[model samples]
Target: MMRSACALAACWWLPLSVPAAASPASAAEVLPPVIDVAGSIGIVTDYRFRGISLSDTHPSVQGSIVATHRSGAYAGISAYTLNGFGELGGSNLELDLYAGYRHNIGPVTVDAGLLYYAYPGSSGGSYEFIESYASLSARIGPATAKLSAAYSPPQDGLNGNGNLYLAGEVALPIRSTPATLRGRLGRSSGDTPLTPGGLYHEWLVGADYELGQVTLGAAITGTDIAAAEARAAGARPRDTRPTLSLTAALRF
Candidate 1:
């Protein structure tokens, strides 16, 4: 759990893999894609990635543009404004370019991909890295569950050390309503300049409601990262504090 990587893992980009429905806001709905080119924009009270706050407890805007093939191949870019972690030594935004393939194996949906985290306008520092990940997901009764793993090899962003993350999530829909309840658990371990030798455990529980093309969300997220370690790594205590966030998003 390097300092830099810790924030990045605050939440898995695909927390509960359910095709077009597996997004952070609709974790329980397993709706397959109905459109080829999808675009979305949203705002979050605090942008926390695997349980760490990346927005310094402030709100942030985020959006993504993705194109998916009927064969399950897709590519996209996602970005958000940032205020902490000295991204690029004080750069205030984070962008990700990613591509991947998804396939159904009987009752299970499998996804594999690569993602590159990029910071613009930061020079003379290690500010970018690539991660590879895969996930397995399936529908179980009235809910869906996912298991995922991500790895980043020794790279400049990681200061020549590797990082690993394992995560799981489950989402259940409310009866006869466009609402969902979701929960997540994850563990991260690694060696890097940010955290030296670090290990962390994190969890989240949340719910979301859909209204036409708009979605509303709220979550309570926390992590078991030691205060001593966080301070030693130059991270704020709020990163490990239980946080409540409200969100709204528009999809098209």
Candidate 2:
């Protein structure tokens, strides 16, 4: 589960607007709750999660839709193409369901969530799992800093008592420009649904250009997974190496 969450962690840093779902109140009254609905569709040179290719180094189509409440609660679903490398019991698609809450306190934001990963038509393999996570974020000068931790309890497809992951990210917006620079670092401990071994690290550096409701992005992502580990896990070692990616997405 932690592995699944780490794979989609890139979505965490987006600065989404929170509009009021209810009417405004007088100065002496409390603000009413609000609701927001957002969705996006995109194509990527490769579907990389935690710096490993889930699309067999091939391009993939991805999309997500989320509904949020002004009170800081949200639920959403995401789906993406999967390749042989994803090892989803022969399934060619991956769907994720998630629910979470986020709250702002002063200049800092705190969040927690649960995610369920599903691979339909999979059999005789560890394919479905769940994870829980918590995170904190704050603006630091021109950059936003975030730290998160996620855990998965012992379940099918995982070894031992599951996995733990810690990650941090920094996002910087270029002054007067539509581009934002981002960097991520993460560490994984315990057995992952994909990798049944020791600890590993993942890293990514990227930039995104926003054009109205569309975004263009590219990144260099890599992981310190060894050949032996990949072999034991039935994964490709090359998939863990630094890879270049270009992506375009439309938001609605």
Candidate 3:
């Protein structure tokens, strides 16, 4: 499962006071730009990854820190608490390291990144894996739409199998209000421990209200996996059931 975190982009401009006789080159010899650092912490009613619950339908705490450069390169680390099910070898923590670059071409914004998932203090075997993702997004009227794909190459952690996830999302901001409506539809295919059924569809409809640096969100999320399929996958009954989740997050 991935922890969704928002980072505040920042840019700094310093005014350099020069003498009247100073040349233009002397004014340009100021300090180099600094990297922007942003952080966030939040709590969720349930820790969901893709369509499955990693926290066994329980609440989870998550946090993240990201550093961004002016050149559109960014790196971040995030962690969340989970139940540490069989797939995780009883490890209760999920940590992710990711880096990517974002660029704008005409009216479209492109983002590509690599993410590494690590389960610390896990036993039995390694539960680490890597995935690469790319996305293109554009603004349409008051709504923003994006299409993304994530792929994991065949590796030992996945038992020599690979996985692919494709998704589309749309977010609309209410005019003259602090609320935003969001929706997503996703499909997961291929072999992976997360989806024992080999394929499944997940969907989410959510809304978020901003209150300064704090934001409150509520969502209804569910997957198409049947009860039997979920059980057979070592997942709890609630994993496949339509559920409501509440979150309170603070960004800085």
User: Which candidate number would show the highest lDDT if scored against the true structure?
Assistant: 3
Best by TM-score: 3
Q: lDDT of each structure? A: 0.71, 0.72, 0.73
What TM-scores do the predictions have? 0.81, 0.82, 0.84
Tens digits of per-residue lDDT for model 1 on 12-72?
1232246663566574355444336666777787777767777777787887777776667
Ranking by lDDT: 3, 2, 1
Error of 3 at 48 (Å): 0.8
lDDT of 3 at 46: 79
Worst 10 residues of 1 by lDDT: 4-13
Full ranking by TM-score: 3, 2, 1
Question: 1-252 in candidate 2: lDDT tens per residue?
Answer: 223452332223333344566344342144333566667777787777766777777787888787777667888888888776434465587888988888888999888899998878766667678889899999999999999998888887575457888899999999999999999998877765554356778898988888877778878887887867766766543333444444444333
After superposition, which runs of candidate 1 have C-alpha atoms over 4 Å from their true positions?
1-35, 85-91, 193-197, 237-252
lDDT of 1 at 76: 80
Off by over 4 Å in 2: 1-3, 6-33, 85-90, 237-252
Instruction: Please estimate how well model 2 matches the true structure, expressed as its whole-model Cα lDDT.
Output: 0.72
- Tens-place lDDT per residue, model 3, 139-198, is 999899999998888876677778888999999999999999999998888866656587
